[model samples]
Target: MCTEELATWRDVSLVLLAAEALLTGLPVALILGASLRRLSRLMVGMRTVLFQARMYVWRTGEVTRRAMGMVAAPFIQLQSTVHGLCRALDILGWR
Candidate 1:
């Protein structure tokens, strides 16, 4: 093989070996890390959705009172529950 191809193969082999080591010693870390990455991505998506929904409710300039605000609260609360995983979920899951 060419010199550059040989170098790339060696680098890839090193990475594979490191991954094998990690899997052998810290399989849970890999699983939890993947889970955390997914959670972070979900939070990012939820953040964008909540931002747009809040902007829609506020900038409409038509729903600026108790009834409108109350109607908006449930949606906001739903988003909050999702974002925060709710008080109960947090308590149960963390413990």
Candidate 2:
């Protein structure tokens, strides 16, 4: 055999190992990339849930505005009633 022939079993094994790497490496790399993408999406969702949970723990619904809206409505209604009564009393000349 020529010296260029892979003369040793070690040389043949090395060539086979390289061929195996070339054949399978592309598929392994693709699988790893797909798994990384899925892991990234899962991490983002987990972060959002963690942030919302943190905000809730900080506020306990105290973040909601206290309602003072109803406080003035009843007084305005009382004033209107008094104005109507005064007008009726004047029309009758009863006061």
Candidate 3:
């Protein structure tokens, strides 16, 4: 009779523990699922914002590079002219 009562108590305790785990774990799982859903949505928006920022930076870099090349053109041309004149003078034995 004591052994039977012990078995019954053990079974009851197991059931209670199962119920407690279900009660706690289910809400935590649901909350985690909801948070993941919200995070995925936010990530979609962030992806688009990052892509736009990248395009803006690319365009700005392209414009700046073109402007720098334009600004340096006259100096490059003058240097080339001077080098050619020096070469010609050397070839003519006039240096």
Residues 1-95 of candidate 2: C-alpha lDDT, one tens digit per residue:
66657568669899999999988998999999999999999999899899999999768655443233366667878999999999999999999
Which number leads on lDDT?
A: 3
Global lDDT of each model?
0.86, 0.84, 0.97
The candidate scoring highest on TM-score is 3
**RMSD over all Cα atoms, model 3:** 6.4
Candidate that beats the other on TM-score, 2 or 3, i.e. the better one: 3
Deviation of model 3 at 83, angstroms: 21
Candidate 2's C-alpha runs over 4 A off are 7-13, 59-95
Lowest summed lDDT across 10 adjacent residues in model 2 is found at 61-70
The superposed Cα distance between candidate 2 and the true structure at residue 17, in angstroms, equals 1.3
Q: All predictions: root-mean-square deviation over Cα?
A: 21.3, 12.7, 6.4
Error of 1 at 22 (Å): 9.4
From the highest TM-score down, the ranking of the candidates is 3, 2, 1
Instruction: Provide the lDDT at 73 for model 3.
Output: 84
